[model samples]
Target: MEQFSTMFLSFIDTWGYVAVAVLMGLENACIPIPSELILGFAGYLISAGRMEFFHATVAGMIGGMVGSIVTYYVGSHGGRPFIDRYGKYFFMKKSHVDTAQRWFDKYGVKAVFFSRILPVVRTFISLPAGFARVNMKKFIIYTFLGSLPWTMFILYIGWLLGDNWKSMLAVGHEASLIVATLIVLICLFYFIRYKRNKKRL
Candidate 1:
């Protein structure tokens, strides 16, 4: 972990905003790279006057959108058949696809929006949304809205920590889990309400 962080930090240091975009894109593309580490360090640089916060945030957001669109396209273009045939190779199961589909069906495009704030879920939500062929305009809009606040929040946290931004590497994980749990609860509540309303109708 330490070694990877060091290398990632170095890459960001050398490439500036481009590195931020690329790394954030990879993370959103369902890669295991953590956004907290990326944006947190970028915040650290902002503190040191090495980078601007606005530019950094925009770069990260754009990268995330692009990456998500790519995945969404893949999912739209026969992602289900591919998964059915060879998902085992990558440890991706049909259940995963089903869950995402259910969420999209139940909550509509809002699932795409809410899922963007989640850690692991955010990385792959696009695929299912794509598979469902959710309206592309709404998908992109909600995706941008959802990612903006998250990017800013992490960047601000990093900036606040300044020289201590590295601490977020650990703290951010715990915080995200807490946030994710709360979101799940909220979604459950809405799901129940929707079911009740449907029955009444």
Candidate 2:
């Protein structure tokens, strides 16, 4: 973890805001790049007078939007077919896709907006939205709105931590686990209820 942090810090230090945008973009693209490290270090730099706060946040947002747009298109175009054909390899099953579809159908706007704030869910929410074929305009608008606060929040946490920004990485990791577990539990509860109702009928 320290190695990844050092690597991202070096890149951001060398490339400035460009690094922030690119790193955040890759992260939102569902790549394994950690936004906590990227924004946290940027916040630390802002404290050091190395980077401007507004500029860094904007760059992060732009990168995040660009990456998410790319993934959205990937899902809109070929995500469902790919998942249907070869999802098992990636640990994504058809039932997972169907669940995403149901969520989007029932709460498309809220799902897109709030999912952007959730840790693990935020990362892949765009793909599901794409699968649902949500309106392009609405998708872009909600995505941008959702991501802006989150970008600011993460950057602020990093800024507050300053030299100790690395500490937040552990917090981010744990938060992700918690969110993932809650989602799984909720899904299981619904599945069991659906089964019981079906048997009653």
Candidate 3:
């Protein structure tokens, strides 16, 4: 883990925005790169006067769009059978896929926009949107809107914390994980309740 972190930090230090873009893209593409780490480090750099926050956010947004586009294309072309076969390896299940599909169907492009602000949900939301054959232009626009704010917030937090940022980041990570887990549990509870209600009807 330390070696990987070192390599990742090296990549970010050397390549700057390009590394951020690729990392964000990969995070969206179901690779395990942490978008939090990328944005936070970028924020640290900005605080150190090494880069502009707006530019960092823009780079992150672009990376997010590109990564999501790749997933969308794969899901669109690969279809359900492919998702069912390969998704499990990535810790995704058919039920989760179906849930995302239903959300997209019910909410249209807004689902894409909102999901980008979520933690784990953000990673897989694009798959169902792609599979549902959502409008590409709308997907891009909503994704940017949703992701830009999130990217900016994390980066800004890092900038404000400066050299003491790592300690703040550790606290933030713990908080984010707790919040993400709670959201997942809440969503699951509601999904189960909705299913039971529908069955009775």
Superposed on all Cα atoms, the candidates' RMSDs to the truth, in angstroms, are 6.1, 9.4, 8.6
Q: In candidate 2, which residue pairs clash?
A: none
Best by lDDT: 1
Q: For residues 72-155, could you state the per-residue lDDT of candidate 2 as single tens digits?
A: 887888877775786566444466456556666777766887677666567777778888778889999988987887788778
lDDT of 3 at 57: 87
User: Per-prediction count of colliding residue pairs?
Assistant: 0, 0, 0
lDDT of 1 by residue, 1-201 (tens): 779878989999999999999989887766667899999999999999999999999999988999899878878896778767865665455666666667777887898988777656677788788888889999999899778778887888899999999788777657576556766787799999999999999
The TM-scores of all predictions, comma-separated, are 0.79, 0.76, 0.77
Give the Å error, residue 136, model 3.
1.0
User: Which clashing pairs does model 1 show?
Assistant: none
List the candidates ranked by lDDT, beginning with the highest: 1, 2, 3
Candidate 2 segments whose C-alpha is farther than 4 A from its true place:
83-106, 173-201
Q: Which candidate is the best by TM-score?
A: 1
Model 1 lDDT-worst window of ten: 87-96
Ranking of candidates on TM-score, top first: 1, 3, 2
